[model samples]
Target: MIAIQDVKKLSSEEYLSQEKTNLIKHEYINGEVYEMPGASSAHVTIAGNMFFLLKSHLKGSNCRVYNADMKVRIDRLNVFYYPDVIVTCSEEDKGLNYYKKYPQIIIEVLSDSTESFDRGDKFADYRKIESLREYVLISQSKKRVDSFTKQDNNLWILESFSEEENLVIKSVNFNCAVSSLYEDLD
Candidate 1:
C-alpha cells in the first residue's frame, strides 16, 4: 500500500473519526494516514499461528493477545499501527478497549510489498513505545524470524532464528517453532 504523504495532514481527532466510519483500515504516523492493504493467506496463517501459540502460552496470565484488527499507539512517536500480532501485559493497556498504548510484543508478518516498510520506518516508529520489549518480523516466504529486543531506551539488540529452530520470545515468555508458522504453505 502506498503512503498518502501528498494528502493533507490529518489531526488525531479527524483520523480517528474517519477510521471508525471507513471500511478500509489506515495507519497514522506524524499526521499522515496510509491505507492498509489486505493480507495474503500465508500472512494470515502465519499471524494466526503466532497468535495461537502466544495465547496458549499466556493462558491464565494477565497478558492479552490481539490480532491485526486492534490498533497500537506509539504515543511518543504519534503513530498508530495494526500489528499482525500484539501482546500486552501492561495493566495500563488493559483499561483501554479501543487501542493499546503499552504493548510488550509486536509482530509483523512480512510480504513482498510491505517488508521494507515494516523493517525500516515502521520499526523505527515502534521503538518509541516505552513498553515495547520486543519487535518481531516473520517472513511469509521462508521459515525465518527476526526479533529486536530493547536493551535500554536507545539500544535494541537483534536476534534471528532459522527454519529448524524455535524463536524464544522473552517479552511474552514463550517459544514458537518457526516451521509451525508456515505449516500449510510451500
Candidate 2:
C-alpha cells in the first residue's frame, strides 16, 4: 500500500480518534497520518492463508494472532502501522483494543509499491520494538518467505524459504509449508 500523507499534522490522540471513525485505514508516522491503500486479491489471499495457519496453531495459547486490521504501536518512534499479520503474547497488550505494543511476530506481504519500505524503513522501525522476535516478509507474486529472526545476541539472522521448504517461526513455535501460504492464489 502507498501511503498518501495528510498535510495537517495531528497528535497521537487525534490520529487515534480519527482513525477509528474513518472508513479506510491510515498509518501514523511521528505526527503525520498517511492513508493506506487497499491490497490486491493475491495479497489478501496470502494474508488470509497466513492468518488461518497462525490462528489455528496458536489457539488456546497465550499468543493472539491478528490479521491486517490490528495496528502495531511503536511508542518511542511515534509510529503506528497495520501489519499483514501479528502475534502478541504479552499480558500488557490485552489492555488495548485497537493496537498492539508488544508483538512477538510481524508479517508483511510485499507488493511493488510497498516492498522497499517494508524491507527497509518499515523493517527498521519494527526492529526498535524490544518484544519483536521475528519479522517476516512474504511474496505475493512468488512462493518465497524471508524471516528475520532475532538472535540472543540482539542481532538478527535472515532465513529464506522457498515453495518446497517448511517456514519456521521459532518465536511462535510454528511451522508450515511455504507453498501453503500461496495456496489457491493461481
Candidate 3:
C-alpha cells in the first residue's frame, strides 16, 4: 500500500484555517493530517458522470449536489474530508458556508491509492453521521458500485451492482444504468 502524506498534528480549527489558505486539500483525523491525493483519470471521469446525473435529476428541488471542493464535518470523529460527490437536502446544511453536517448522501470514487481507506476507516466515521442515509463507493478499476443504506435499526445494508445492472439510490428516488457511469474510458 502506498503511504498517504501525513502532515504535522493540528487542531480542528487549525486545520480549517490551513485548508482555507492552502491550495491543496487535506483530511484531518484526530490531530493528524493526510494530504488528499490527485484522482486518476478514471476516477475523475466517473465522479463527473455521477455529479452531472445527480444534479440533473435534482434540479429545481431542495437537493443539491456538490463536488469534492466541499468539506464535510464529521463532528463525532473530529474529522474533515472532501467526498467526491455530496448531496444535501437539509435547510440547516444549506445555510452553512464552509462545511456540511447533514448530507443525505456521500459518494466516493475509488482509486488504487484511496480505496482501502475510503472503504474502511472513512466509512466508519461517515456512519456516525445521523443525517447520512447512504454511502456509495464507485470503483475506478471496473464498472461497479457498493452502496450502503442505513436501515431502521441502524444496520447498513450493502447492495452491490456491477456490469450492466442499474444502480438505485432510494434516498432521492434515483436510478441509473451502471454503464452510464463509465461512459468514456480507455
Candidate 4:
C-alpha cells in the first residue's frame, strides 16, 4: 500500500520538476503527490509477460509498448501515472519528454495492494484521456484479462477473457491467444 503523506502541496509544474530528481516514484494528482509502492514478483512477472507479448506484436507498427518506467500525462485530470504497460500509436507522443500525453492502450497488472485504486481512482483518471481507446487489467493471480473499450459515443464497453479464450484488440487490429499472455507466469 502507498503511504499517504500530509505535506504542503505544490503546483503541478513544481511537482513535475521535482519528481524528475526524486529517488522514489510518486504519482501526481492535481497538486498532491502519493508515493507508489514497488510491485511484487507476481505483479512484475505479469507486467513483463504482457510487455514482451505486446512488444513482439507491435514490432514494425506505429504503436510502441512501454513499461512502468514511462509516465502518462492525463491532461484532463492534470495528473500523471505510470501504467504497467502502455501502447501509443500517436506520432506526436514520440517527443523527448519522459511523459506520454496520449496512449491508445493502457494495461494495469492487478495486485493485492493496489487493485482497488487501480480499478477505481486510477482507471477513472485514465478514462479522461481522449486518445485512450482501451484499458486492460490483467490479474496476477489468475489467467484473466478485462478490457474496457470505448464505443463510438465515448461509452466504455467491458469485455472479459480467460485462459480458455482468445483476446482481441480491435483498436490495434491484433488478436492473440489468452495463454500466450500468461506464459511462464506460473
In terms of lDDT, which candidate is strongest? 2
Model 3 alpha-carbon drift over 4 Å, by segment: 1-8
Instruction: State residue 96's C-alpha deviation in candidate 2, in Å.
Output: 0.6
lDDT by candidate, in order shown: 0.89, 0.93, 0.90, 0.86
Top TM-score hit: 2
Candidate 1: misplaced stretches above 4 Å? 1-7
Error of 3 at 124 (Å): 0.5
Where is model 1 poorest over a 10-residue stretch in terms of lDDT?
A: 1-10
Better of 1 and 2 by lDDT: 2
Ten residues in a row with the worst lDDT in model 2?
A: 1-10
TM-score computed on alpha carbons, candidate 3:
0.94
Ranking by TM-score: 2, 3, 1, 4
1-186 per-residue lDDT for model 2 (tens digits) = 434555667888888999999999999998878888689999999999999999999999999999989999999999999999999999999999999999999999999989999999999999999999999999977789999999989899999999999999997789999999998886
Error of 4 at 140 (Å): 0.9
Per-residue lDDT of model 1, residues 40-153, tens digit only: 988999999989989899999999999999999877777888999999999998888778999999999999999999999899888878888999999987789999999865
Pairs of residues at least 3 apart in sequence or in different chains that clash in candidate 1: none
Model 4: lDDT of residue 134 = 97
Q: Kindly list the per-residue Cα lDDT of model 4 for residues 45-158, writing each as its tens digit.
A: 878988888898899999999999899998788788889999999999998377899899999999888889988988889988999999999888788999999998989999
Please state the error at residue 24 of candidate 4 in Å.
1.7
